[model samples]
Target: MTTNQLVEQIKQKKSFLCIGLDVDLNKIPQYLLKEADPIFAFNKAIIDATHHLCVAYKPNTAFYEAYGIKGWQALEKTINYINEKYPEIFTIADAKRGDIGNTSTMYAKAFFEDLAFDSVTVAPYMGKDSVEPFLAFSDKHTIMLALTSNAGAFDFQTKEIDGKEVYKHVLETSKSWKNAQNLMYVVGATKAEYLADIRNIIPDSFLLVPGVGAQGGNLQDVCKYGMNDNVGLLINSSRGIIYASNQDDFAQMAARKAEALQKEMALILG
Candidate 1:
């Protein structure tokens, strides 16, 4: 989807919430196992139940990769279902992929052409050549890792180099890559304090923030420092929402969780 289209959805729904579909078979309701495809079954229910409450759906590819072929098939079915059923909803393949240029192009094609996700997360450690290939696709976004929410982020992302932080350099350097306008970033919600400096470098770019609820990142603080004129943020809550309950009412429980976040976003937007 286009940036305007994504922003329009956020406005129409009064939300910028990005629900993560990181399904774990161990955590899902056992009753779903009777289905022909439990993974897709679980995802379909969550999507149906919570579609209206959020602007985006992100399926972390690792969950599917773990299940091997079955996992990949389920991911295909999930993305196809979303594209056919809810074309306006921005879909993210949270693959965190990055490699050499040729390999990166293939990765881009896999997610952008074959699976048809609106965006995909990528690592920037390999520099521009590795990430630019993904940015080459039209109407698609490449969300590169910046300041992540995980504890290990400080190990490299915040380290200094030539008087500037590594992530700051990543943010500034990425701005000059090919099709830079299509670039977004992954800034962890846990690092809300760093947003002011991040904004100084790329104020208009969208940020896919993961680490609210379950990770204990404060929503109010994220918006307070991270929000822009367009309210550029996709706050992700995965296990906290999807795993709200493992009973027959799991989907409804997920909806409730998502709705609460959406309501918070609505108030923030207002």
Candidate 2:
């Protein structure tokens, strides 16, 4: 989806919430295992239940890749179901992939053409050559990792490079790449304090922020500093919403969790 389309979805839904479909078989309800494809079954239920409460669904590729071929099939089915049923909802393949130029092109084709994801998360370590290939795809977004929420982010992201933080440098330098308008970023909600500085670098670029509920990132603080005129944030809540309950009523409970966040977003938008 284009940036305008995404912004419209946020306005229409009164939400910028992106639900993470990071399904863990062990954590899902035991009953789902009876289904032929438990992963897809679980995802379908959650998507059906909570589709309207949020604007996006991000399925981290690791969850499906871990299960091998069947896992991949499940991931395919889940993305297909969402595209067919809820085309309005943006889909993100959280596959933090990057490689040499030729290799990165294939990765872009895998997610954008074969899998049909609206966006894919990419690592920026390889610099312009690695990321430019993904950005070359028209209407498909390449969300580069910036300041992440994990404890290890301090190892490099925040460290000074040429008198500026590496993450800031990533933001500034990325803006000069070809088709940079299609570039978005991953900024963990846990580092909400840095958002003001982040915005100053790229105020209009959309930020896919994880680490909210489960990681204890304050939603209010994220909005306070990260929000722009277009409400440029996709606040994701994975375990906190999808795993709200592991019982038969799991989907309902997931909806409740999503609704609560959407309500909060509505208030923030107002």
Candidate 3:
């Protein structure tokens, strides 16, 4: 989807919520295991229930990679379902991938062409040669990791390079890459206040923020510092919403959790 289309979805839905479909068999409803593809079954139910409450759905690739071939198949089905059923809603492959230039191009093709995800998360530590391949695709976004929610982010992201933090350098430098307009970023919600500085660097770029709810990041604080005229944030809530219940009402409960966030976003937008 185009950035304008994604912005339109946010306006129409009154939300910038991005639901993470990081399905775990251990936490999903027991009854779903009876289905041939339990992961897809769980995802379908959740998507069907909560589609209207959010504008995007992000599936962390690790969850599908863990289950091998069947898991991979489920991942394919899930993305196809979203594209066919809800073309208006954005889809992100939360696959933090980046490698050598050639390798990165293949990875980009895997997610952008074969799977047809609107966006894919990538690691920029590999520099321009590695990340530029993904940014080459038209209309497909490459969401680079910036200041992450994890405690380990301080190890390098905050470490000063010359006079600025590495992440600040990242945001400033990435803009010079080819097709940089297709670039988005991953800024963890845990560092809400940091967004003030981040916004100053790239006020117009969209940020895919993960760490609300289960991770204890405040929704309002993120918006207070991160939001731009387009409401440039996709606040993700994974465990808290997807695992709201391991019972049969899981999908409905997920929708309720998403709706609560959407309502909170509507108020923030107003």
lDDT of 3 by residue, 1-270 (tens): 888988998999999999999999999999999999999999999999999999999999999999999999999999999999988989999999999999999999999999999999999898999999998998799999999999999999999989999999999999999999999999999999999999999999999999999888999899999999988899999998999989989999999998999999999888
Q: Give the per-residue lDDT digits (tens) of candidate 2, residues 206-249.
A: 99999999998999999999999999999999999999999999
Query: What clash count does candidate 2 reach?
Result: 0
TM-score of each: 0.99, 0.99, 0.99
Lowest-scoring 10 consecutive residues by lDDT in candidate 3? 1-10
Candidate 1 Cα misplacement greater than 4 A, ranges: none
Deviating ranges (above 4 Å) for candidate 3: none
lDDT of 1 at 217: 90
Please, what are the lDDT tens digits per residue for candidate 1 over residues 37-104?
99999999999999999999999999999999999999999999999999989999999999999999
Which TM-score value belongs to model 1? 0.99
